[model samples]
Target: MQDTPSFYYQGVAALARSIQVSDKNSKFVLYMNRADYLDDFKFKKTGVNIEILQSEYYISDVEEPESFPGSLYTLDVIKKIAQAESLDEYIILDPDCLVIGEIDSRFLERHGCNIGFYKLIEGADYQFNKFPFERYGKDINLIGGEVIMINTQGAKEICQAIGSITDRRGLLTEEHYLTVIANQGKIRYCHINTEVKRIWTRMSYRNCADRDYLYKIIHLPAEKKKGIPRLFDKIDFINSHDDLIESIRYFTWLKESVLLDSISKIYRWTKNFRGRA
Candidate 1:
C-alpha cells in the first residue's frame, strides 16, 4: 500500500486482525515509504510477529508521468527487503486485505515455482496492453497484484530483466510486469478456490460470512478511507469469538443505509422523471 497516512490506523488494525488469524509460522512485514511515520505508529496487541521497514529504494526515475510515482516501486522495495534478509520466499499483501482464515503455507510450497499470483479469467486485457510484450516475446495473463508470493531468486532475475528494457514505451504497471514475467514460465498461479474476494461497495459486506474462518482473504481496497472504522467494528466484534449479534447489528445498519441510499436515488429520479425525457 502507498504511504497514505490517513488510512494508516485502519490498515494497521486490519493487519493486526489478519495476523491474529494467519498461520502461526507465517511472518509479516509492513513497508512504509516514510521513515518518520514509524514514530507515531502503534501496532495492536496481536502477539503475531511483524516487522516494519522504511523503504528507501524507489522507481521514480523510471515511472511514467501519468502513473503515481509510488506504484512501480512496490516490487522493487520488496526485492530489496527480501535480499537484505536473505529470505527464500515471501508473500506480499496490500494492507487493506484482511486474513479471515488460516493461510496454508503448503498451498504456496506445493507450487514449487518462482512466483505465485492470483489468476483472473476476465481482466487480462487491461494489463496486457500496457507493456511492450513483443520485445520480450511474452504474452500476458491477468495476474492479480493484491496478494502475491515471491520466490526471492526468481524475483531478482525478473527485476534484472525488467530493468534492462531500454526501449520501454511507458512505465510498466506492477501487475502487468508480473504478468509478463510469469508468462515467461517463471510464475505459478495460486488457485485459492474462491477463498479470496474483493469488496468494492457496502453491498460486499453482505457476502462476508459471520464466521471469519470461512474466507482466506477479504480484500477491502475500496473501503480503505471511510469504511475502515465500520469494518474495524465488525472485525473487533467477530474476533471476540462470540455470538454474531453485534456484528449482525452493524451489518443490518449498513444494509439499511445502502437500501435507504438506493431508495433516495429512486425517489429523486422519479421526481425529475419527465424533465429530460
Candidate 2:
C-alpha cells in the first residue's frame, strides 16, 4: 500500500533463491501485492512450483503500524498465511532473508525439539533497541521477526494471538508481541543465533555480531538495495550455496566508498542489460 511495497522485487529474488537451495518436496509460496509481480523477474527455474499468494488485507480498519521503523502489518501477513495454508511445518521469512543450507530439516527441529522458534535471544538492551522488558517482564527471551519457525499447532496458536493482539500496541511491533508470548510462557524456542543472523549493513554494522558463513539463513534488513539484488541476480542462474557464500560474506562490498558505489551500480546495470539480451 505505502510506496508500492518497495521490497516486492526482493520477494521475487527471495523465492527463486529459496527454491534454488531447497529440495524437490520443499514447496514455496511467494506472497505479494499482485499475481504479476514476477512478470519482470528475469530468471525462471524449470519445475519450480512457486505459488503466488495475494491475500486480501486481513485487518480492514487498522492501517500498517507507521511509527515503528521498518514495520509492516507483518503479523497480519503471517496470520493470512496461517489461515490459508496447511503445511505440516510453518515458517515465515522476510524478503530480506536468504536460505543458508538444507533449511527444510534444520528449520523443522529447534535444538532437537520440534515446535520451537529460531530465536535471537536479546538482552535488556540489544543492539540499539533497548527492549521494554518491564512491559513483557524479565527472564523471558525475545526474538527477531526476520525468520520464524513453528509447527501447525504453534502456527494455529499464533494465528489466534494475532487477531486479538496485533491492534493492541500501536507503536509496538509484532516482534514485541512475540516477546509478550514468550514472557507468558506460551511457546518453546532454541538458540539459533548462528543459524539466522542479521547481516549488519553500513548503517548498523556496530550492532552486528561476528559473521558466520554457515548460517542457516541470512537476514539482511538494511543491506537490501546494495547486496540482495546482486546476490539474488546470480541465483537466476544455476548456483550452489558455495557460490553465494563469498557474495554473502562481502554483502556491503558495493558500499565500500563513493567510487565503489558508482562502479558497482554500473557493473550491475551492465549485468542486467546483458541478461536482458
Candidate 3:
C-alpha cells in the first residue's frame, strides 16, 4: 500500500502479486494522473512488466471528480489507450479488483466479441436506480463498470455513445452509458456473470454466501476504504512466502469485511453523537 490511505492501493498491490502467482505471462498498464505516486509501492514481480500510463484526466470516481478524480473520463482514457497501443482487445479493470485466477490466457480471448462486460448481479434490473437507462434499461441487468473487455472498434463505438449522451439523469458514470450502448446491439457484447462478481460485505447486500473460489476476478468495491488495506497485507504475506492459496482470499474477505463495516458504523455514529453533544 502507498503512504496515504485516501487512495485505494490494494487493487494495485493485488495486481502486482498476481503477476508473481500466475504461470502464464501477463503485463499491465496502470492509468493514473501521476506516475510518481506509485514509487513507494514495491512490486516484486520480476519477468512481467507493469506499465504506468500518466492519465490526462482522473476517472477513478464517478460522482466526485473534484474531491477525487472519478470515472467520468474513463471512456476517453480507455479509447486513447486502445488507439495508442493498436490493441486487438484489452481489459479495463478498476483499482478495487483482484485477480484470483487466469486472466491473460489465450483461451480467455473472445475472438468475435466487441465488448465483454461483467455483470455482478445476474437478472437484477436497474442496478443504478438514479440513471434512466435508455432502452431495455428496466429489463436488463447491471453491467459493472469494473472489468471491461473491449477491442479498438468496440471502444470507439462506446465512446461515441457516451459523448452523444444528452440525458445525464443521474450522476455521470461509465456504467450508465454502457447500459445505454449495450442495448443498441450495434457492438457485439457478452454479459459475463460467473467469472466476475462485485461482492458487498454487508450482510443485507451480500450477493453471495461466501467469496467463491471459482471466480477468476473479484470486484470488492466496498473494501476500498478499510477491508482492502487489511486484505492487501494478507496478500503481501502470502505472496512473499509463495504459498498462493486461493481460499485465503475468501476467508480474509469475510473477516475484514465484518470488522471494517463495524468500525465504519461506529465511527459514523460517534461523529454524529459528537455533533449533537
Model 3 earns a TM-score of 0.71
Tens-digit lDDT track of model 1 for 1-277: 3355657565666566655655456666665554555545455454434454444434453455545455555676556644754545666777676665567565546666655666644432343335554665443555666777666665676667556555545445576666665665544445543656554334312323334336677665545665555655556554542223344234333233456556656765675686677
CA lDDT of each prediction against the hidden true structure? 0.55, 0.56, 0.58
Between candidates 1 and 2, the one scoring higher on lDDT is 2
What is the lDDT for 208 in model 1? 32
Q: Is candidate 2 or candidate 3 better by TM-score?
A: 3
User: RMSD in Å for candidate 2, one decimal?
Assistant: 9.6
- Candidate 2's C-alpha runs over 4 A off are 5-8, 22-25, 36-38, 46-65, 68-73, 80-87, 104-114, 121-134, 137-140, 163-167, 207-211, 236-238, 250-277
**TM-score preference between candidates 1 and 2, better one:** 2
TM-scores of all predicted structures = 0.67, 0.68, 0.71
How would you order the candidates by TM-score, starting with the best?
3, 2, 1
Q: What is the Cα-based TM-score of model 2?
A: 0.68
* Steric clash count of candidate 3: 5
lDDT for model 2, please: 0.56
When sorted by lDDT, best at the front, the candidate numbers are 3, 2, 1
